[model samples]
Target chain A: MAKSRVLVVGTGGIGTMAAYALEKGGLAEATAVMRSNYDAAIKNGIDIDSVQWGQVKAWRPTAITKNVPDVSKGDVAPFDYILVTTKNIPDVPPTVADIISPAVTPGKTAIVLSQNGINIEKPLIARFPTTPVISSVAYTGATETAHAKIYNDDPDCQKIGAFTSPQVPAATAAEAAKRYVNIYNPTGTLDVLYDADVAKVRWRKIAYNGSMNPIASILRMDTPRMRMSRHIIDDLIIPIILEVRAIAEASGVTLQSDLVDVVIHQDPSDTGFKPSMCQDLEKGNLMEIENLVGEPVREAERLGVPAPTLKIVYGILKGLQLRVKEEKGLWEAKFQSGNSYE
Target chain B: MAKSRVLVVGTGGIGTMAAYALEKGGLAEATAVMRSNYDAAIKNGIDIDSVQWGQVKAWRPTAITKNVPDVSKGDVAPFDYILVTTKNIPDVPPTVADIISPAVTPGKTAIVLSQNGINIEKPLIARFPTTPVISSVAYTGATETAHAKIYNDDPDCQKIGAFTSPQVPAATAAEAAKRYVNIYNPTGTLDVLYDADVAKVRWRKIAYNGSMNPIASILRMDTPRMRMSRHIIDDLIIPIILEVRAIAEASGVTLQSDLVDVVIHQDPSDTGFKPSMCQDLEKGNLMEIENLVGEPVREAERLGVPAPTLKIVYGILKGLQLRVKEEKGLWEAKFQSGNSYE
Candidate 1:
């Protein structure tokens, strides 16, 4: 059988890592789709660097920008799977929907979402009902540094499964998992868990993200220091976790562990680890505050669960966002004035 | 009549300002008492440069540090008023109490607190019951730049009043107010209000301080940007103000207006103000968070008024404090390591 063609969307840390892993696993011939043409070229070059295998040379994948020609017109072949690893910002989902609609052949293609947070899966499924959409939880940490180089903090581990009504066939899902495991499991690197309780997994991830990310971001502290500080655990993290858990329970998702336990038990010596939310905050990028903290707090209010802690933190984070916006405005004004003087 | 001798204790911004105003208004011969010998000498030199008339100006009053000789001998008279302007940290009240105890004389002397916050009046009054303790609110701004120069942001105004219990006999309080108004009203700079609603005034000031200061500290943003940012107002300031109001209401003090209007509607263009809290945060000095937000929120909670917003911002601020502590520890460890190497 001909090798299945795969299109990995987004050339960020996660997207680049996924493409690299897929090509190394030999499951499919992958092409990374980046938003910028410059980024696409850079990402393709990095894929080429990852091609050198153990004591032998290996394969390289193609890179395509968002402006890639139609697959039906023979410009590029149809992809068997479209993996999206972009941040679920306001424009991302719709952008993905528009780009992937023409490339998707229902029943023949699968689109996997490996982004953060919950509630995204349902919306995408609603948008493309016929297309097989797989919800994925990535445990690995992939960091993108300056000059667009991708480094995998966690070498290999991913949890992928189907999350839908009239769920995809178990046999087919298992086969897909096996294929992924085999491809990425060089030197036994990837662990594939076929979780029927994917919602639980998603909520568990959300709990961790919700607790650590915002606290780290707002405080501008790394995860280890945040974990080590009892003040942070008692004051910010624990209350937020309890509130998030309440929201999860109300939404029918059972998170596996309590947030405080996870934070306290997590090693403080892992000083190199920064929550992704902190990375976004440092970059002055738009945060997932609404989805991470706001949505759960809003839900808790609807459920009549008193989430005072979450409400306050959400307000603070929102306040910081506004302050940053105002500063940017002032900076822009000054910059324009300077330009006029020049 | 000879000018009543006055000693300005805790010669920081407020203390120095009071001294300058008092001398300029020709109501008192003003002496400054500072914690350090350097500060006393510096402040004395500053007063010499800035004094308006050469009559009281030649009376360089006294500039004495704690270790200075006991100048108040048998024939030498004690100061009529001791104006205390110490910082509102945990160490402040005890330190100030110890320093000014010797200066307190039952009928002849009174202590005026020209500092920020609400709780200091009760403690000082309790400590020195026989001596009059007047709580005064300063509305103007001052910054100390040099040993011989002090800059006033709003030199045209200062407010002084008797805000204490077992009410300093109305006649005595009014006379004291008039005396203070005369002395600190250089070119009529002071505004003295002698209403029974002093608690309300203090609470209103507390509301403004609690709302603007801590958030400014946390975000490291200046007043104009913070006030202009709707996010900060909605997320941080308003909630904090609400918390303050709730606490004030619980304490039976009627606040003048909703704090939100004060923060949101306050003209940012006029003041060129940056909150003292931000200055403390930038300097990594101990913040007045406990007194400003924590104490009020705790009071509100004790009163069964939900201060969710205040609690969260307080938590985050506390968290930031802890993070700073950890960083300090790390820096100390690194320094110790370097010392060992040396």
Candidate 2:
């Protein structure tokens, strides 16, 4: 029997886990691609110590590709699943479309975006007009401690669906959603939810993303402080959440109003946890600032809805990202510290 | 003619300059009180390198006092002027009243508050009802370089008046304002605007402090990035200004609508300037978070007006301050960092 082929791009903590889960579940033969940590990941494979999913020791992928061209074109077998776990930033080089293009093997590929933020699937969908694309929202307390090594205290569900932007839950049929869920669910490693209301779910996740990611990152503090901060929740965090809800409503998605309360009072988070944005910031690496903060803010602004909290937060995080990227020289362009593009 | 005695408390960068300006201005026989930099200030006097104001080398005070009692009682003549320059954090002990109490010698002393934020004079005003109190707004490009030295790039106006909070600008008559101005104006170093509308000006300054101070501090960013942040100015800063204006109007002062524009665009805040809040955070010292961010937020909340931006920013900053203060353990009360009282 031939195992299904899955190529996971952006092999950080999230990608590593998805690859590990897929292979361990006996659902597919997974391949991973890495850039800087390529040699380490290729040699060491991935080691994730997750409380929920027990232990996966040296779970190497079936194949390792250094670059996207290798994963997309160099491989003989067409990938059944192409998972992108990188940040979805606009304008920055190597757009997700560019990275995932070579792997779009028509009938064979199912482009699954298991990244953060909302409405991100549109651009990738636009690029691959005919290819089946799946939007995913992964909730896991996971962070990369070292090359190919992740330490997760808690693990949560990953929601996936076959829906485009402005597409509501009712519009998205269950066939692709079921197929996407089936790929990773058998592992019993994670709670995989087949989401019909992916737009709402994405927006719901974004409510958390917009509130937690940038604010926590900027404060350089973690979830415990943020969750316990009545002031932060009542004044800062909730307003951004509500604003996201309003933006969603304006865009004709009826999100559950209690989502704000859910995000605020959630446990384990109250015990203090750092989101990926904060984690990346602490490491002085580039953050998903544009995707998590900028995109929603601009979207709300475009819809004539005012999201003051997100706007300012986005500005601060953008400044931080620019400064970090500049200092780390992670990318080509450099901005002088304390200076901006005037 | 006998010299009029002046006592200056809190010799940080702001306090250092005010002491220098008072001495160099020859307005009074100035005595200074310092906690951390007492010996340095006593040995070196105060050195100020100014962009607008000329140099002042070893500008010694009439006397240097370490404690308020020393300044209030150690000096021979009664203090005609009592200047307090530390932050006004509520319930933090050594409140503004505590710092300037001994000098509140009935009519013999005129209490002057040249600190940042709004209605800071209320406590001192309440303590000495009969004493003439002056409120001041100093616009200076200065940072404490050495123990007793401040490097000031620009010397701007010091706006002063004698009025209580909720008092309209039109009601302010500036006899006390004039006298206070006479003391600091003789330096010919910084421009001194005897603001009749000190209420409006203070509110306007709060518009800046409430927005820029906490945001920048939490982000650990400075003015150029903060200023270059269009989203910050347009979305975060402006909304806060408007909210403050609404609160001001609710409190019976209709601030000029253009104050938002002025705060966002007009200030000659030197490039790469870090607000006092940011400076405080960097030192891991206690911040004026409660006063600068908390007070107005609570005030707005009390006034039945929603100040979402201020509330959230206040929350994040308060968290940062609590965390920093806990770690520094400058005083006894430890806020279980990352733990909420609830």
Candidate 3:
């Protein structure tokens, strides 16, 4: 049988690592879609210095395409799976779903979403009604230190499950998810586990992300400083955890009772790690606010759950996101001169 | 009759203006205590470029003292009133009350608090239990552009009231408050009015300060930008206003009904004004967290009022305050290296 073909849409830290893992497994042919880094990657390939896999010099995937649509032209075989590992910023236009839609062969391709935040599969599910959606939660301290140079400190572990739709039967979706995991984890080096309910896993993950990410960004503190502040842990972090739990419960996902304790102490006090959201703000990049905090707050409101903590957190992140957008020239602020109070 | 001698403690923008006003009134002998700005203020005086009171070069008070203690060294009459116009950052050590305590004559001199926040007088009342505590809310757009070069855009107006205590009769406290206003507004050039309930007035002011000041600082937005963000107004600002109202009500002060709308539209869209707290953050100065947001939240908790929004806001601001303190070497953070979760 021909090798299973995979198209990775985003070649950021997570995408590059996932593609590298799939190719290293020697079960599937992986093609990376590099936009700006295409020339560098095509010429030099990717230099990955990872703790889990050691140093791999100038490693290239089976093929490299500048654009997604370019890979589909001229009698090419259809891709079995298209994995998206971009930042889940739904607030920005030309979302990941739209960007990867050109190459998707509707029902033939399984769309795998490996990113942060809860409800990230909604857009992909909306765009591809009949296609199987693989919901994935990727955990790896991977980052691109320089152009075409990746640095990963943590092991690549992914919790994989299928987003069951009425169009795709549970058995079919699960089979698709299992197949993708099998191709990526053939060597069993990467700890990729199949989860029966990825949505519950996402809720658990967001309990940490929804609390720590935005708060760390807003406070301008790293993990160590945040954990050190007693008020932050008790007053802010715990409340947000409780709020997330309420939101999850309202959405029919009952989080663990010890979830607050789990989240408060998730990072070691000396870790001093800055969350991705915090790094985004520091670099003036658009944050993953909409999916991480905004949607959850809106869902809470829709479900009649009192998510005051989340609402305030979302409000603050939204304002900060606007400032970032305005600074980056992605959005403009409109104001008129008049009296403040009448 | 001898002129009423008044010593102004904090000579920041507001303190400088108050001293200028009291000296300009010609009914009181105003003495300004300049700590860091003493040399420049004594050498150049305060060059006033006022919108209300036109340009006055080298405007000196009745006296200029380097330290509050020095003002009482020689054969000098006691100060009838000590007006404090510094930032209400009670979190920092050597509070304004403590700094001005050396020159205070407990029973003879009435301590006037012309600063921000609700329970600011608590410290003063605690320090000088027998002394009458006069609470005043000052509104002015004033800044020191250069060394001792003062700029006043908005007119100086103050709502004066007395903090009635069992130690001091309401009539005596009210009489002291009225007397200070009379001295400060003898010529009526300054719009100083007497308020029967300054606590209520402080609550109303905090509806703006508590919502706008911290949010602007956190978002790095000016007033105009804040008002233009509809979600910020509806979700963050209004909810904070409601929380402040709940806190105020639980503390025995009922806020107005249209407070949310009032706070929402308080600043004109084109004002582009950065509240004092925002400016403090920009300049890396300590914020007035204790009195402005901290006290209210604590009061709410004590009174069993659920101030979720305020608590979250306070939590965020507290963390940021830690950052500022760390930057300024006012505090040190301690962290330990261990497993985050067991």
lDDT: which candidate is best? 3
| Fnat for each predicted structure, in order | 0.30, 0.30, 0.82
Order of candidate numbers by TM-score, starting with the best: 3, 2, 1
DockQ of each: 0.29, 0.31, 0.63
Task: Give the alpha carbon lDDT tens digit for every residue of A293-338 in model 2.
Answer: 7888878988999887887777667767766756776533323543
In each prediction, how many residue pairs overlap at the backbone (N, C-alpha, C within less than 3 A)? 1, 2, 4
User: Local distance difference test, per candidate?
Assistant: 0.64, 0.73, 0.85
- By DockQ, is 2 or 3 better? 3
Clashing pairs in 3: A336-B270, A340-B266, A340-B267, A340-B268
Cα lDDT for residue B321, model 1?
Answer: 64
Looking at candidate 2, what is the lDDT of residue A175? 62
Q: Give the TM-score of candidate 2.
A: 0.84
Q: Chain A only: give the TM-score of model 2.
A: 0.87
Locate the minimum summed-lDDT window of 10 residues in model 2 chain B.
B164-173
